[model samples]
Each structure stands twice: as C-alpha cells, then as structure tokens.
Target: MTSTAKTPLPPAACATALDPTAEPFYLQVLQALDAAGVPYVVGGAFALAGLTGVERPTKDLDLFVRRADFDRLDAVLGDAGLRSELTFPHWLGKVYKGAFFIDFIFASANGLNPVDDGWFERAGRATILGHPVRTMSAEDMLWSKAFIMERERYDGADVAHVLRGCGAALDWHHLMDRAGPHWRVLLSHLVLFGYVYPDERDRIPAWVMHELLRKLHDEMLAPPPASGRIQGTLLSREQYLADLRHGAGDARLKPAGTMSAEEIAAWTAAIGEPHEK
Candidate 1:
C-alpha cells in the first residue's frame, strides 16, 4: 500500500508534541540515511509515534539493514560524520553514535528473518521533519513490538498501546501469514500483558491486541511445523548486559570526526544514491 494510505492511529498518542527536540534529530538522521542510500525501515519508539500520531520521546533511532552490508553501512555513516559505538562481533548489528544513539540491527538473532526482506520491500513512505522517508509497515511494527513484549524486554503497556492504535490499519491475512508459526508465543504475550483476560483470551476482536492474539492462536498455530532455519545466534540477556558494561570504555564507541560545512554539503548531495545493487 502507498504511504499515504489511511491507517488507524494508535491510542493514547498525543496530538501535541511529545519531544520536539528529539523528533527533529530523528528526521535529520532519517534524511541522512536516505541520502547515503542506506536502506532502512524505522522501528522502535519513533515508529510507534509515527503510526499512532502520538509523539513518544526516544533517545535513539533504530533501523534494519541486510547482513551483508555492515562495512558499507559504516562507510555511509562515516561519510555523514557518524561512527559505530559498538559492533557485536557475535551479532552482526552495531550501535552507532553515542549522542544520538542509533542502533543498526542487521537481523533479529531470533527466528524473525522472514519479516526482514519483506519489511525492506514493503516499507511505507512517510514524512518526518519534512523529509520523505520509508518506515516499517504497521503490521511489522506491531509484530516487532509484540516480539519484544513476548521476550519481556519491553513493558506490556507499551505494546498494548501500539497494538490498540495501529490494530485497525493492519492487514490481518498478511499478519496471520507471517506470524503463523509464532501464534502461541504471541498469545502468551497478550495474556502476560493483560490485553486479554484469562477466560476471554480466545475471542479476538478486530482491535489491535485482540487480533494479534487471535491471529497467533487461530492462524499461526493451526499450521503444521516446517523445517526451521536458524538465523544468527543470540547472546543471553545476561551476556549482552555484561558486554555492554565491558565495552563502556571503548573509544570506538565515540562519534567519528564532526562534519565540516563542506562535508555536510557533500553528504547531502550524496543522499538518495543507492548503497547496494
């Protein structure tokens, strides 16, 4: 669908600005990514805000890139005067720029790789800070949040908000098809989040949380198991936390050289050039 397609907004999204300061910075980064020809689909809080029309102040920008292009991505960011803060050697993803705190996720270490290529292809277009950019599909955004919520990495309420707001706009069949095998996990998340009361959990409404839960139980779980393909391995949460602490002093985390006026101009000129064939 086109970017301008009328999609339902998330509930509890503020009509007024939530974080004016952070939004502008995010837009700049989006523009930088586009100019550098770096393909990305916006994720996390900013994406939640974009879909719901609610402004959620977030500290960093999250983007998804293919696994093969890490070095190319580093060069693109370098051209734009940003630098990697941490490269998870075991994980292909890296954290870039401390001040802005951008995280470039190559692929989920979890078994969510099926969504990767599709997300990049179907990314909806949007205007952030007056710059035209691509964003994750509302369905994909909800799935991402649902995945995180299931894993207990995020608050259940946040996932609920995203679901309630964007639920109406999602393509149920498409979501069910992609989320088919993970229905149990998704239902478990809904139960954990209190989106559905225990007795009433089986009845999914057209609403966001309910549909997601129902889709998980009804569609995803009904299918027979296929041969699963493992993606990259994931570090345990404890291991990841420890690595973050250990990498605290690494200067590689520091931002690369600041962009001079001339460099900024050149970088802007280079925006929209394709990064990969």
Candidate 2:
C-alpha cells in the first residue's frame, strides 16, 4: 500500500511555537536555501507533525541533504550572514543564527542510512514559510528514527505514530530494502507498531509479517557467529557502553560497521550528561 501522494503541510500557525526572535532566522534560512538552489527536504518535528498531525514545539529545524550538498551549504549559509558547523563529520551539520540553529542531516548517527538520491526520488512536494520545498518521505523518516533508541531519547513511539498515520500509504517494500542487513530492527518496530495500535494491526501487509517472521525463524535456527558483535550499540552508544567495556565489538565500528574508531570516540564524548535544562 505504498503511495506517491504528498503529505499536507503543517499549518503555518505551528510556526508560532518557535521562539519569536528565531522565527525570522528560520524563514531567512529557508529563503536562502531556495535562492541558492540547494536541494533539501524538511524533516525533524516538521515532518513528524505533517505525517502524524501531532505538533510539538521545537527550537531547531531539520533539513535532509546529500553529503555533498552539506559541503556546499557551508558557503551558502555563510554568504547569507548565517554560520554553520559540521557538528558530526559523519552524519550531521548545524547552521547557526545566534543560539537558534537548523540541522542539516546527511546520514544517521549509527552510520547506517546516509541520505542519497533515492531519498529525493521518493520525497513529496510541500511549502513552508512561504517557500516551496520537499518533505521527507514517510519511509525514509521512519528508517532514520528507528535507530534512535538512546537512553535519553527513544523514538519507538514516533515510529508507531508514523505507521498508524501513513497506514497503506507507506511504501513497505522500499522501507524493507532500506533496512537491508538490519531488517531485524525494522521487524521489531513493526511488532511494536501492532502492539501500540491493536485495532490497526491489519494496516501492515500480511506478506511483510510473514516474510519477516520467516526470516526471524531462520535466524533463530542458525548457529551463532564466531565474532562477538554487540548490536545494542547501534541502537544507543551510551546505553551499550557497559557492553563495550566488558569486551564486545560494537556493530557501529569499522571491520564490522560503517563508522570509524575516531568517529565513535568523538560521538561518545559529545554525549551530554542527563540533566534538566
């Protein structure tokens, strides 16, 4: 039950939730990107609210771009009187105007799914702050959020809302392929989706459940691999620190994963201590 229909944009009233002073900067950033012809899709709270009709206040905006566009954005933002930094070399960068900023994401923190051409191919047309723009596809948004299971921030609920909201409109096949070698993570989220929305269980295609279950069965029967890979780290770097210290390889590290050792150390160091703002 996949679809190509564009999601309705969240109401302009939602913009009122942002800091009043920052609103102008937000609009300027959008206008700057359009003027510069830098292709990007609106994501983060904007996409979540668009797909699920659930609005939440957010200080930061998210724009998904290809890796190369991020490099170009460095100059684009600067020329527009804005500044930005590559917050995480592997996945994210932030554009700043005073204390308010927008995130330009090119990949996931775990280094699994990087933004690529396929993302734009599936993106939907939308308008925000009086500027025409693309919206992150439901499938791509779900793929990114599925891996965000940090102790401070778990997105399983967000994943379930997307499933409930998109229903048959979701491109299940594309999502499955996007999951690739990490299909189990997708399967687990699907299981939880059903648990969260009992009456809407049938929203998921029967064949998907059947296929994933069959794969799970095969996985269960297979012999454990000789290598000790702790996939929990892929879900949350901080939560799995104990495992790494106790002698287990992180699935997010090189030779076994997509990220580098230096990148992992830097990411771990950036984790802020849990506290009230």
Candidate 3:
C-alpha cells in the first residue's frame, strides 16, 4: 500500500525467470543495484526457482540487502530514475521504475531472519533474466521460508523442494546455527521434507536428525512454560492478531527481535495491501 506507485506490470510480464523478456525494467534495476556495489542476494521465487529449477511468474523481484545499506540503495535507485521508498522501515522497501518494481527486503515478514553480510559470503551464483547474479544459499532460503505459513500462502513446499533438490549440498552445521532459537521450525520442515521425498530421505545427514531429536526429547521432558506466550505471530503476523490482542507476547517484540511495537503495528496494518512481501 505504501509503494512509489507505478503502472505496474502484470504478473504475466517481467517475470523473474532465468530467461524472461516480457519486461526490461527489471534488468535495468538489477543492473543499477549491481553497479552500486552494495551487497544483495536474489530471493523470493527466483531464488527458489534457481535452487529448484521450477520457473514461475513473480510479481516483483526480491533483492535481499542489509539494513545498513538501505540509504545507499535508495540513493542509487533515485539517481537511476527508479523511485525507492522504505515501505516498511522495519524490514521492507520498494523501488519503482514505471511499470516494473522490485522489493529490497532486509528482514523476514515475521521479523525473524535479518539479512547479514554472511549471506553474500555464502551466496550461490545464478542467471536471472540473463543477468548473472548471486542468490540466497539453499540453507538461508529454507530457513527463511520455513515460517511462511499464512492461510493465503505457505512456503512449506518450497522448503521441501530445496531439501530435495539441494539438501545433499547444504551445510547442516551452518543451517543449525541459522535456525538458532527457531530450531524446531527447521526440524519440522526437515521431518516433512523426508516425508515428502521418502526416496530421498538419505539426503539428510544422520547426525543432524540425531541432534534435533535429542533436543526435542529434552524439551518434551521439561515442564511446560508457565507464561504460555503465543509466539505463532512469529510465523504469520496477520493470522495471529487475536492472540496478541488477548495479551499474548508477540515474539517480534524485543528481547526476541529488533522490531518495535510501532514497526510491528505498521507491518501488521499493511497486510492484504497489494504488492506486499
């Protein structure tokens, strides 16, 4: 709802596939971002398409950049005639060049995964719309998509596909650290990945499962939390408003994350707005 409005391209045009040609504006934006020397990795459907080899039309390109680079990114876009604005200062921004636009996302919709320098260090190369670009690693993509379980859109299948397509190459130890306090979300996706691709269950390393299982076993034995905080908001900010309104602790709040109440409110209010993350 807060984008620098443009005569946006239809979903059928300017797709983010490896060989798209319906729209040329996306390429221009990507070229500008690259020329600026600011670190970013392709994300959203294109990144998944790169990892899974399933091409599909995307409304906009997703460029994952760090918060520290927002100002520089905005300035660079402006110089190139691509109007940019911080759509949600907490996590997302948008750059518009007439009919085509791209998202400059710095954090997850749930305010969980914040883009960091390590992402570029671990990035894999890909060709999007014929432009050679870096992409989010399979582990980072899986980690970020694991929590996208809204009623309208769920990325569980994406997570499963990443595991099936590139699970063997994933650095499980690094992934474990990425999940950190959210290891259970990672484990759930892994369990389902094995279920979804029973023939490829061997793709998962044995020790990873053992470690997660031991953690689960220990937690199940421990006493339940007396506070009973409803952290489901961390997975879908729009779907869990009722619980938060009833005084449940929003995991997006501090001590848990860097998002503030005002930021959470802005992000929450932007739900259902067209062309959102």
Candidate 4:
C-alpha cells in the first residue's frame, strides 16, 4: 500500500488554519484510515472547501479511495470499530459510526471513471478535521461532479465553483483526458462556468476551449452516429429511463455511449429509492 503521509497535525490544543474545533469523531476516522495504511484522497464538501475556500455545511466526510484498495481498507478499518458496507456496489461504500458515516467512493455512479493512483498524484495536501489528508484534484472533482445532474443534487454549480477557484491552475490536458467520451459534458460545464463567472472566463485556457469548440463543431457537422439511440440518459440516469424503456427501442442507440439497462438498474437499486427526473 502506498502511504499517503503528510505533515502531522499539531496537538489538539492548537487551532489549524482550515477548520478549528474539528469534530473529534471525524478526526478518529481519519486517524484510523491513516493508521490502517489506507490510501485515500479526501473529497466532497471538505475537499472543495479546503481547495477552493468555499465553505459549505457538509453532512458527512467523503473518502475517495481506489477500488483496489477497498478490500484492504475493509480489512484495516473493521478492526478499528468502523462498520463498513458496500452500500452502493458500483460506485460507493460506507463506513458507519452510528448516525454519522463516511462515504468511500471509488467510481462514478455512471460507472464511467474509477479512482486510481493518478488521483493521488494530483491531490493537494490539507488538514481535514485536524488531520493531515490528501485532497482530490480539481480535474478529478470536475470529472466526478460533471455527472451529478440529479434533480435534488445537481453539482453543476460546484463544478463552476471549482473552475472559478482553480481555473488556470487546473491541468487542462489531464482534465480533457478525464472527460473522455464525455468531453461534451465538460464543454457544457465550462461554457456555463464562463456564464456564471464572466470575469474569470480567461482563466480557462484558450486552446482548451478551442479544442472543445472544434469537437462540438465537428460533431454538429457530422451525421448522427446512429438512428434511435437515446443519448438523453447520458445526462441524467433518471430523466431518460422512460425514453430508454418506453420510447421506440432504437437499434442504433449505442449502449457503450451511455448507461446500459443493467447499469441503470444497478444505479437505481444502489440509491435505495426512485430518483426524481
């Protein structure tokens, strides 16, 4: 296991610059993960706040670990009294401390991107809950947050906030690669980010925009890839289920481009409730 060591936090009497009076339980959780030698990158609201200085009330801590490390994590944390469950097998796992919990995420709900060691390489250092931790990269955060278009939990705004904060500091090339087949999704967010923060538009590299725009232009000029393929689900898993199920089953709909029926079912099941379109 690759150790994710950072400068140890000072004693509890000292107030860290990030979050003073951090919850002791959260600190315990971080300590356990670290002591167990779990390689994880802190993510979610804590990470966003740490990196972008955007403080939001987060319900729980999010620990982003590689899928390959999950079993090891389970092995180590279980002895520390943190009960874990593969709650959402495709993308999420959970470590519970009674009412409070930590989210252990390895993949996107869409099953497109998975966490790897590269995530740690680009990670920033932070003192979360008064414990030294690695923060997820802005590029990976953008890629992960790009897919969250649910009715109740739209993360487009968060994506824009990251761009506003990281902007020129972001690794555009790596981000572009992370966007992959979903480059259009990234382009949409970047366009909207420009709209949301007009003055910061130049923060994004001109070449990045040019590449995305060129791709968009080519896509527009090109004929449809196939007939009857419902691309709607790619945007939102819940929004296009009707189109995928009841709408004319278009043979040309490339299952590879978007979530297949099985993936959709698993995602829906994983959430433990029906999603609002």
Q: What are the Cα lDDT values of the candidates?
A: 0.52, 0.82, 0.80, 0.72
Clashing pairs in 3: none
Clashes of 1: 8
Cα lDDT of model 3 by residue, 56-87, tens digit = 76777889999899999889888987789998
Candidate 1 displacement at residue 92 in angstroms:
6.1
Worst 10 residues of 3 by lDDT: 5-14
Candidate 2 per-residue C-alpha lDDT over 191-217 given as tens digits, one digit per residue, 9 for 90 to 100? 998788776777788889999999999
User: Per-residue error at 158 for model 1, in Å?
Assistant: 3.0
> For residues 131-226, could you state the per-residue lDDT of candidate 1 as single tens digits?
666777767766665544323245455555555566545576776676664655555555654444343332234354667655656665577544
- lDDT rank order: 2, 3, 4, 1
RMSD of 3: 9.1
Per-candidate TM-score against the hidden true structure: 0.59, 0.91, 0.89, 0.83
Model 4: residues >4 Å from true position, as ranges? 1-22, 247-263, 270-277
Question: Candidate 1: misplaced stretches above 4 Å?
Answer: 1-29, 89-98, 109-111, 149-152, 190-277
Q: Rank the candidates by TM-score, best first.
A: 2, 3, 4, 1
The C-alpha local distance difference test score for the whole of candidate 1 amounts to: 0.52
| Candidate 4, position 233, lDDT | 57
Best model per lDDT: 2
Index of the highest-TM-score prediction: 2
